[model samples]
Target: MATVAHEILSHIYSRIVSPQVKELRKYTAFSNNVYGELLPTFVSRIFKELELSSHQVFFDLGSGVGNCVLQAALETGCESYGCEIMENAAELADKQAVEFQERLKLWGIKAGSVTLITGDFLKIEEIGEILKKTNLVLVNNYAFDAELNGNLVNMFLDLREGTKIVSLKSFVPPGHNITAHNVESPINLLKVDEREFFTGSVSWTDAPGKYYISTIDRSRITKFLNSQE
Candidate 1:
């Protein structure tokens, strides 16, 4: 109880929002519609579409509220991890993971535990370590953070089998999907996951925009990640 409380407080300190961020971030981008307490049914359905496994690793970048990680742990029996940079937000993720683990044990659920790291994804060295344990990477639709997302995507793509990357982009494309710095390639450089029309509304990727996933190759998931250059 004490540990969970402390972890919860850790998140209360790090995050700052304009109106309301009372919910979890979904997809690889950690985006949401109606933005509050877990993602909309639309995003969840998209996850179902992916059909991940227990042995593989699932990572959520910018894991707000650590909802996806908790969900992953509960459903897949796979190791769930969240990457958060905000000191307060990261703290919240850690606390959430702890809570989820406790709940799983109490229920005798055969789910996986989560590891939430507090740090910027830009730190290649640090992210590399996380990648070592990761099999599936998720990206939400926050296009502004595309540079960091791309770097992470590129890194994860380099791995081999048992490794898969999923980048969630807003279907709108123009709004949050990160711009491909150069014309050479939108996907070539970023390795975005396949785009899925998650929600019926245009606001799939938080803030009323379509949502899509920039997924990585399934066959080369682990191999590519292990062979990172």
Candidate 2:
């Protein structure tokens, strides 16, 4: 039954996602490359490697189709939330969440709930309210420039200690002392805990795409920033 349900879900996904991606591409203003969905395998890897459980609260900043949050909710039964700036992408994500919720019920699984917010992540007034309680946060910022990345790191300062931040790129090089020469936009808070090359799909292609995953240290956030000053 599990195998049959997996096959059914695959068929449903292939049918729905092609048109959804097409419709979203027509409306996305940002670089489409950065807006692709994280593969299911990658999401599983994240949960397993991090030892995440139902006790965690997950947030996906700049969540494109909200796949990360959806996977977190379904796999770990974690409280998951996604913030998307693109309206079409947000709508598609909401639709997918509803569909997946129904499908999971058919498989006798009760997925954790998900919330999709359609707005700029930076402008979300409830970010602090969310981040304060969050345990894990995902950011797909491969396309973000230095300034925007700096802004993101600054915003993360509000997260409670012990929260984890997973990002696609490193804000700074690892094993280097925090000297002025090593400083990149004064993001002294986020300490790099892990860096690895991960393989995943992009744009419905069979060809594999390579991306970096970096985990940040939240416990040392404030202390590290103050030491740097």
Candidate 3:
């Protein structure tokens, strides 16, 4: 019954003013990378691979309008948190969170919840404390690319001890030197932990073409995160 209700509402929302927050509206006015919706099947597959717990807390980094957070929590039984840097985007995400929860309630889904944050994920004042309560983190791989991705990874590593990072990376360094640099930077900073990664190519609406998604293990990532703290 609840599932049916949520689907009805979601279908209606797809036709309404969703993803139309005051601030986010203007972003598309200039650059048009805003994805109001993604392929549900793809997202669901990715979420399953993330291995989220229904009772645990999940955080979405660079969470545009908070869709991922809402989806993960609603579908997986976890509490959801969305971190968006842009003010307008945050506002939109907040709106989405509220509506998603309401829709869930109408459909009879309970225990799951969602929250949104409007600030830099790297310097989100006192975020480490908040992250202490979280168990899973999702990085929209194409969202960071090669730019602030490193900093964000380091930040997530400093989060909770058992916190898992499931990032979608799209960059592959041309030279081993770049790889060495990523390897040595954290080591020199005196932070080291278990590290693992898987690399592959895929096409996303955000990237338009196939690109590499380099998955990093927690041990190696932990060293960098701990160092940043």
lDDT of each model, Cα atoms only? 0.52, 0.70, 0.57
Across residues 95-119, which tens digit of lDDT does each residue of candidate 2 receive?
7777887777777777677888989
Report the C-alpha lDDT of model 3 over 1-229, residue by residue, as the tens digit: 2355346446534633354544454654323234333334445555566567687888777777766677777677788887887676676677666666666667676646777888877787656766778777666655443547657655654565545555545233334222335754532222222223322222233333332323344465455556667
**Model 1, span 31-93: residue lDDT tens:** 222133235344345446666667777887666657677666665567888776655556566
- Which is superior by lDDT, 1 or 3? 3
How many angstroms is residue 178 displaced in model 2 relative to the true structure, after the best TM-score fit?
2.8
Candidate 1 yields a Cα-based lDDT of 0.52
lDDT at position 143, candidate 3:
43
- TM-score per candidate, chains pooled: 0.60, 0.80, 0.66
User: Where does the lowest 10-residue lDDT sum fall in candidate 1?
Assistant: 12-21
For model 3 the TM-score comes to: 0.66
Candidate numbers, best lDDT first, in rank order = 2, 3, 1
